[model samples]
Target: EPEVTQTPSHQVTQMGQEVILRCVPISNHLYFYWYRQILGQKVEFLVSFYNNEISEKSEIFDDQFSVERPDGSNFTLKIRSTKLEDSAMYFCAGKNGQRSTDTQYFGPGTRLTVL
Candidate 1:
């Protein structure tokens, strides 16, 4: 079965550094989303993209964050000038978008540590 996955299972970076988190979501999925979970906090939606365009974004996804489908197959998230508060597990999720009840699948997530 196809599944979503992220690269650099773990990453460590200094504050103000730039980081590009990559996600390889199920190719057949029509809708893709990005979420983050701070160490002890619950998951929060960051952004959603479809048809290679950003459909929605949460307040958490500020000017420093960007999402793209550079190759029409890979989903990528980039955080510029990463801040200490940016440290967290970033996840890539997707759904068929064919029905409201469609199950959303999520990747194991990439652990990002900003010091």
Candidate 2:
């Protein structure tokens, strides 16, 4: 069985500082995504990447945010500037194929704390 993994499991930063969250998905997966969940809130989709390009994105993924697959194995999300409201659990997810029944595996998540 394969799963997603993230680095820097927890991050604490001052408001306005930058942060980069990283993840590695299953090697054979064809789709990758980034999501966030504010404390006690619903999981929100931030962006989805395929073929090294953004396939989908939500309003939450504004100019201040960006994502990159710097290499074949690593996917990264960067926030140019952090805000108190940006504090949340960021998850990396992936799916092997685009099927309604395909399972989307999720990483444990990186907890970002903005102070």
Candidate 3:
């Protein structure tokens, strides 16, 4: 079975530092997304990407954040400047392009700790 994969499983950064998190989704998936769960909070969608452009985004994906599919296999999220409030577990998810009702498969998540 295919699954989503993320790198740098954990990261710690200073308040003003930039951070980039990476992920690789199941090969046949066509939709990709980023979601975050602030410590003790529910998971919230940040953005969605398809056809190599952003398809949808939430209020949380402000100017400080960006997403990219640098290549055929990798998707990434970058924070221009980290904030203590940004500390959370960031998840990368995807769903197969062939199935409109397919459940999204989520990566294990990258834990970001901003100080």
Candidate 4:
């Protein structure tokens, strides 16, 4: 079965540098999303994209953040300026266009740690 994959399972970065988290969503899926989980918080949706444009986005997706499908198989999230509060598990997910009951398959996640 195809699955979402993320790179650099764990990353430690400075408080003001930039970081790019990579993901390869399941092939054939049409909806992709990015979510984040703070150490003890529930998963929070950051953004969702389809047809090469953003479908929906939450307040968490601010000016410092951006996402793109750089190629047919790769989707990437870039953070222009990291902050200490940015430490969290960044999850990449995909849905098979089943809107009625879409189940998102999530990657293991890239733990971003800013200090």
Best by lDDT: 2
TM-scores, each model vs. reference: 0.96, 0.97, 0.95, 0.96
Estimate candidate 1's alpha-carbon lDDT, on a 0 to 1 scale: 0.94
- Screening candidate 1 with a backbone cut-off below 3 angstroms (N, C-alpha, C), the clashing residue pairs are none
Q: Write the per-residue lDDT of candidate 1 for residues 1-115, one digit (tens) a residue.
A: 8989899899999999999999888988989999999999999999989888899999999999999989977899999999999999999999988577988899999999999
State which candidate has the highest TM-score. 2
lDDT of each residue in 29-55, candidate 4, tens digit only: 889999999999999999999988888
Candidate 4 vs. true structure, TM-score: 0.96
Judged by lDDT against the true structure, how good is candidate 2? 0.95
**Where does candidate 2 stray beyond 4 Å?**
none
2 against 3, candidate with superior TM-score: 2
In candidate 4, how many Å is residue 52 off? 1.0
Q: What is the lDDT of residue 25 in candidate 2?
A: 95
After superposition on all C-alphas, the RMSD of every candidate to the true structure, in Å, is 0.8, 0.7, 1.2, 0.9
**Can you give the lDDT of residue 66 in candidate 4?**
96
RMSD of 4: 0.9
Question: Which segments of candidate 4 are over 4 A away from where they belong?
Answer: none
Error of 2 at 15 (Å): 1.0
Error of 2 at 42 (Å): 0.7
Model 3 over residues 56-80: C-alpha lDDT tens digits?
A: 9999899999999988899999999
The whole-model lDDT of each prediction reads 0.94, 0.95, 0.94, 0.93
Q: What is candidate 2's CA lDDT for residue 30? A: 86
